[model samples]
Target: MEQVPLNPSRYPTVDYEEVMNSDEGVRKWTDNIYRWGFSLVDGSPATPEATEKLLERIAFIRHTHYGGFWDFTSDLSMKDMAYTTQELGAHTDTTYFTEPAGLQMFHVLSHTGGSGGASLLVDGFAAAQTLYREDPDAYNSLKTVLVNAHASGNEDVCIQPAAPFPILSHHPVTKELCRVQWNIEDRAARMDVDAATLVKWYDAARKFNEVLKRESMERWFQLKPGSPMIFDNWRMLHGRSEFTGKRRVCGAYINRDDFISRYLLLNKGREEVLGKI
Candidate 1:
């Protein structure tokens, strides 16, 4: 077996042969490569049907409001719907939800015109760790505070009331600490903190965002006509670099537990084959 990089530029391309014929091999490969993130077989013409197959092969399929067919041209009205536009800042998808999807796959069907619209991915776990080491107090404050976020203009747009979640959390499967904060624009005012502490909290968060933006902790790539990028939404936060060209894509979400269950079941099958199960 070849050695895996600490951070791979792109996940190794494995044909269905490697993934289906030997469950053990697939488990071992995905475990290591996707510890932080991974991508699947690329270079094939991307389509909604192909995307569904890729997702079904792994485990249960999940969805958000953004799920299903979305055309960048006709969906101009959705631009204000949060995360509908091609221009997006670094954020974990649907952090406001009580239970955000653990994994996300974005399939790009076409990109006609776009300059600097490359997808940006940052290691949120790594970034949070850095903050914890440098500014423990700020980190603790974020974890303790309850963040409120709601869509403006549309009253029905407000969702799930307010929920308290740590900016940093332990991954339910990997047990690694990961960053969870998303949607900075809709964050409600902090009510518990005094004026001084609130100011400090905002400042710390601002600084962290700035550092994350400028830091070299990101890997960039443009989704070609036939490739889909699979990401660990809990551990990796993604965004677009902003582009004017027409970009059409479909996205779906899956839970972390579902991913682990599928992965472990495959591993068990492998172990049984090896007489170790």
Candidate 2:
């Protein structure tokens, strides 16, 4: 298949045949279909065992209690979450984590009572690179800024210790640039800077954000009943469109290194068999 550029209007439907049969094929397919992520097999599994088997193939499994099975909740710590009355703005998950997980999978257990809750993905690596090329100083400033994210409620509900991280980072495996900053709900208190420098930094960040939003390079897809969406959490940022009614999803996070290792190991086994032939 010819490669498709990331564009919301021209997004292509990924065929199941290309995704489920083999690791190598899936890798190539993911490179093309998502250029950022992939949507895998959908349809009610024949049995619970099949569901477990499919889930096992993935690297991680996780959930959030604040959002129930059908909860359409936003990551409340970010300012963009405030602008969004119904939909989440584009962003990578867990920028606060010291080492953010590389991949994320969302299984759509059900989506009956809603409409317009589509998943939106943007190539953060691509966006950051664009910023680097167009505004190097701004990009550099973003890299140095230590973002602080926290919550003050119950220990379980509040983010502990106010995690701090850079706004941009190089991908551990691909070495590609990826955006690591998100929702400006909280600022790092530990970072001490002159008033003038702080204002300049915020201005630069705002400019970079405008560039990302105006680029029109986002891919949008709806997770309907039975289909699960798997994405490179490190490379692509994800968001959801607002919708009425209920929208429940099951999610899991797997280390990117783990997935790459599995992919490589499976390929090595194939190479060994071919050598005998």
Candidate 3:
């Protein structure tokens, strides 16, 4: 069965204060993130400290080379393109890691002297499902073919997963669709597969990319201070529109294990919460 594409507008925003104080609010907020793969928090304190606190409210931040709680702007301090004033296509973060960050939070502190910079989010699960129904061969190719990715912009540092991973991954125990890893910008040029298989994989990847960019599958919105967004990195691809001004953003990553433990505990004994991830 094809999963319905996510529409952030349909979900209600939960107040940060309520979430921090009430169990019911926490349930609603967590449920929104699990079901829709994302949630927006209202009435949050607009500061880097507040952003860190809000993320810690859910789970401890997973510290990476980028650091635990980031407050960055378009200064090119980092080697990645995210620090540049350019358009970034929809892609999941930490693709080069053996275990990618599970959840990502974003709080746009400020944006000035720019007209564009609307956020781009696409439901990768929905896009994959659509491709399965429309082109099974392409879907299967993505499911079976292994691809490599790397992060090597840093002068003396480089990162890549120990082994290549397929675009579609299923949980070993549950055999359920657990991840959708797709990042054209991060994909490595050297693939381990034969030329014939690599050709098929590229063709499949193109088709999958097309599906991901479909208008119906994309949710576009502008980020504002005091309103933060938490999204599942495993199920959604996030990006931004090109802009020419300074933009300050702060956020952090939450480990998959920590997030799942928190979710299961918050909704403990409520088997209904065990819906398809």
What root-mean-square deviation over C-alphas does model 3 reach? Answer: 2.8
Give candidate 1's whole-model lDDT.
Answer: 0.65
User: How would you encode candidate 2's per-residue C-alpha lDDT over 1-277 as one tens digit per residue?
Assistant: 2334555434443434444555665455344323535445545342334444454464444433233122233334334352233777777665545556566666655555557778777766667777888889888778776567654333456553344666786567886565455655444455566787677778778977786676475667876655666677776777778866655555556666666555554545657646755
TM-score of each prediction: 0.80, 0.72, 0.93
lDDT tens per residue, model 1, 110-149 = 7775555778777776677777788888777766666765
Give candidate 2's error at residue 210 in angstroms: 1.2
Candidate with top TM-score is 3
Clashes in predicted model 3:
0
Q: Candidate 2: which stretches are off by over 4 Å? A: 1-35, 42-52, 60-85, 151-163, 171-179, 185-190, 267-277
lDDT of 3 at 1: 32
The CA lDDT of each predicted structure is: 0.65, 0.58, 0.86
Worst 10 residues of 1 by lDDT: 1-10
Best by lDDT: 3
